[model samples]
Target chain A: MNDGARLAAADRSARVRHADRAARFVADAGQTDWHDAVLWRIRGKRDAAAGRVEGWERLRALASEIKEHTLSRLDEYLAAFEEAATANGAQVHWAADADAHNRIVRDVLRARGVRRVVKSKSMLTEECGLNPYLEARGFEVVDTDLGERIVQLREEPPSHLVAPAIHVRKEEIAALFHEKLGTPADADDPRLLAAAMREDLRARFLAADAAITGVNFAVASTGALVLVTNEGNADLGAHLAPAHIACMGIEKLIPKPEHLGVFLRLLARSATGQPLSVYTSYFCRPPPGRELHIVLVDNGRSRRLAQPDFRAALKCIRCGACLNTCPVYRRSGGHSYGATPSGPIGAILAPGMDMKRYASLPFASSLCGSCSDVCPVKIDIHAQLHRWRQVAAREGYVAWPKRWGMRVAGWIVRSPRRYRLAGRLARAWLRHAPRRLRYGSWNAWGRARELPRVPDRSFGEWYAAERGKK
Target chain B: MKVGLFAPCYIDQFYPQAAVATLELLERLGCDVAYPRGQTCCGQPMANAGCAPAAEAAHRHVAACFEGFDYVVGPSGSCVLHLREHVEGAPDARYYELCQFLVEVLQVERLDAAFACRVGLHASCHGLRGLRLARASERQEPPFDYVAYLLDMVDGVERVPLDRPDECCGFGGMFAIEEEAVSVRMGADRLADHLRQRVEVITGTDMSCLMHLEGLIRRRNLPLRVLHVAEILNGSGEARNG
Candidate 1:
């Protein structure tokens, strides 16, 4: 590994690894959405100038209430959604895990006697591993979203929730396109690559027999689904396909469309600094005789809801704003999440699926609270992440070194004398210490950066000395 | 009033000047300051590393050291934030982050110091986010303006801003070393943004971040200097340091 890789790998097993990963949501997030954030800042400045836009805060409040009310009665709405969806002749399957979710999606495609399917940006599909499962099952799956298609062509995963292929620079994407489609075109100009992808995917979007897309918000009030996309690919995928399959976690349900305004106001503003996204499209009830499937996959969400504290995580709108604002996410990038939906929201949700599987995610924050501040509906992502760390510790999902380290620390903290003794010892240790202390992970941290030198006299000693004179 | 001046270990050693400024600032603000010398670390290194247990001793040492002081104030926000959040018994111990102590407790309106330059406010994540001295994110009503309020008081200072205000510089103690690339990238990004605004100097409460940025600033031979907000507020002006 290169120095950077070796250093990052050294941190892979640290207690703050999750915190480290979450901090960079900004740098790593919206790599594709760079265009999006600039757009939003422009929109934000303009909106600021536009005097008062009525129903903005009220809309977020209403959206928050809708989500709140929906989650409060989640069982009822989910049941209603399943009932309406099944009655409308759409197959509804529940998957407990990503494996199961992927299997169900693959099975749906096979059952329809379809071999090829086109897709838009859906975090659920990425989380469920659906495309690979289908591809592995001898079916072709084409990504319709320009970003998703670029990542698909490159055999990579989407880096951001909204913009899947964010990590690939346009030049690299141009090369990917150059390799995939004999379009020996210059890839550096994003406009050129996007236009090239649009041309190539337009044919696939038309020929694809089925389309699998992620539902942005599923309305229980009318069994209608909403999707907000900058690329407008979801609309195209749903519009052209004979079979439209919407994959969503159980938590996206809100009672009414009126409530979407609240989340919509905050979502685009926080995610991209846009006053609102370019399009917020809703699809309620399929056109007569079309096959529409809504897979209400649990994928550990039900289990998260089973616990009162974590169910709010399901309230996510998938704007990736939290990721964009996170310092950890900005630095580490998304691939380290090891699963889809990497970022602040991803850190909290990943722990639920397998606390150990994604144990390191909770430490992804500097505890900056930017994610919570930026969150449209106001999810306390950092707090939830801390709770996850406690849970992971309780669940025996700690590294041996950290556990022992904490155990030793726990003994010292609650006991004052031991704490003082420890300090004196450390001071003495530092007094004669060489340039470095090459023990454990400190070696790695002390390499690029030197530890702050310990003082000979503790603050308490100075206090005592000065206090005695007084 | 008797105040326990929490000189962060770093301040007590490498950056004694900040501690001295803090001590003088406290005294000028009308309080007898006591240096709690027995205190070494706030145990933040442990708590942040998810080894709060290990921090227990450090916490006990600090708490016991400052047990008698009517209030505790520190020049460093990271340390004071640690005192406020992670430090044992700090919540009830009448603790104040340095700027907070100046603005709220000591309640100093006019300071005997001035620097006539474009000052970029580097809100250390601890002071900016942890003690939440200024940030309210989005839900916060009208946003509590603490840091800006204090900086505005500085004479002839133009508070140059960054594109993403309140974003982290990625100096998460261990993080800078572990994810060195991302950490360095984040620091460089923040530094570049500050430079982009053409601020003559960058200042914040946490010297750790400032020190990291200072290293980068020196490496690039940038004209800008990094100063602790405490030093700036105390009128201890910064000159170019090699």
Candidate 2:
């Protein structure tokens, strides 16, 4: 397929039919409960990790301020970063869109005659559909991160940002390894499965001709690429491969090396509850024989930055803390989001990418505001979700039934007389309606919950009779 | 101080007793409270559904009705939050959720009320997180709960501890029907937590949440009951065994 067709296909697949998909996930009550418990445990661990710090909230605020500062004068920082990176002997490429991004990577690999590539966990690469694009053109792409590889082997998208394959069970992984990598069929132990994955990844890493990694932080002053990983696989891939390419969104820039300390302290704790990742590797310059290429992709981020209502999302450090703490995300699972980065952050970002396609994302939440509280960068995620709903409605993405419902309800609520009449009629219907009709298919609430029993008099009616003279 | 009582549409209709209890509770606390007759709804339903412009008329109506009051207090946190956060050209500053008004506005040091029942306190999301009426579990700040403090002041109110104190009851307006399956599942889990603690009555700052849980309880023929915090604090809960 052409790039446009491919992108259209990806967009189609990513359009979240949230309610329908969430219903499917919640249908299996046992699985939903298990998912909720696992994520809640992660949230608990994050709380403990964050609580141990003397000024964790302060660190989060500082990080948010630094990001806001960097984004405000992004043009100047981008120039500085390009100059510094070039001085450090690394080539930097700018891609205005995803098509340009995918093509740039393809051209780089083609020029180097790279046959096989190993990629660490990069949500940006997933966002650009890089793996599929490269594979279709006959270059073998293997995900090196253990969780990423599990999903790659299963031919599915990574479910969570940090854990990637968090939704999958160990028994399922053991079965997958047995089918694909010759592991013992009964090897459901986590350690054994991890060992098998490590062994399999080792061979692929050694044989790979190129490496692609996602940048955690790009320092403008130092011209460095920072990668935070738990498995140490990204370091291996970037060092062992003959050519290394780092893909990052424009929002990834941090002003100086000193500012990195604040984010580094918060990233792992909020992500996996570790004080720091096992591999916090920084690449300043390419190794002697290998070449380093940095692809700065815009891909709609610049547009988001231009909007004040959404620019706070740019402060995100890609921590999955919001997802772990989100009750909806926990019960619905990541796949229900049908976006690359599925959760509160994704809900805000996806709509800007394609309003018509991802309209359901913004409305998926209950506006519970927990995501905002746990956010390491203090992104007002729930507020953004609320804002995006307005955008969706204005853009004609909201369904007609809801739109008309709101319109009629709005008219009724604006006038006390109309509202009173509507209330009286509703109460009368509730009190006198037939059982089958009252609890029918049209009433979603009545499927599992009974509607409120109507009362004899409204509070307004009671007040007029008893307290009007007083 | 003269207060304007803003009972949400649902509370005004199906759960009028909670509104009555709120009025009585406020009066007993030595405040002059008036029910604004022209008040119907707070425009929250439209605003939260993403039609903010459509809610303008309702917001103006609210401002007009409660214009002269010293404070506009509502029994539902969800509705009050919408007024504070979403309403335009409305009296946002004067709008207060019932617990917030009692704790922060009235400074009620004591209550001459009691209900001998094991009650599960459902921390409605808007009250706990939006209004900052309590310390949300997600934050590592100084712990406080206005609703619980008021509950503690009443005699014989056994506040049963929940495994998950502040998780949402999934009664997000329109969310209840829009994402019915997940909504029901979330509400079910919340009820399960209360049932696990052997809670005889589930009470909260908002009747919307209780209405959702109560719907489930009635459907299943559960022994538990739901009461707004106002009813329990007004000394009416002890008389209602059903």
- Residue A145 displacement (Å), model 1: 1.0
lDDT of each: 0.71, 0.90
For model 2, report DockQ: 0.85
- lDDT of each residue in A233-300, candidate 1, tens digit only: 88888888888988888888877667676666667765665666787888777887678888888778
Rate residue A135 of model 2 by lDDT.
86
lDDT digits (tens) for residues A1-470 of candidate 2: 54644654675666579999999999998789888999999999899999898887788888888989999999899989999999998999999998899999999999999999999999999999898889889999999998899998887888898988888987888899999999988989888888888888899999999999999999998889999998898999999999999999988999999888899999999997899999899999998978999999999988888899999998889999999999899999998888879999999988989887799998899889999999999999999999999999999988899999999999998888998999999999999999999998889989999999889999999999899899
CA RMSD, predictions in order:
5.5, 1.9
Chain B TM (all candidates) = 0.93, 0.97
Docking model 1 quality class: acceptable
Query: Could you tell me how far off, in angstroms, the CA of residue A143 lies in candidate 2 after the best superposition?
Result: 0.1
Q: Going through the candidates in order, what is the number of backbone clashes in each?
A: 47, 0
lDDT of 2 by residue, B1-32 (tens): 99999899999989999999999999998889
Q: What's the distance in Å from true for residue A85, model 1?
A: 3.7
Angstrom error at residue B212, model 1: 3.3
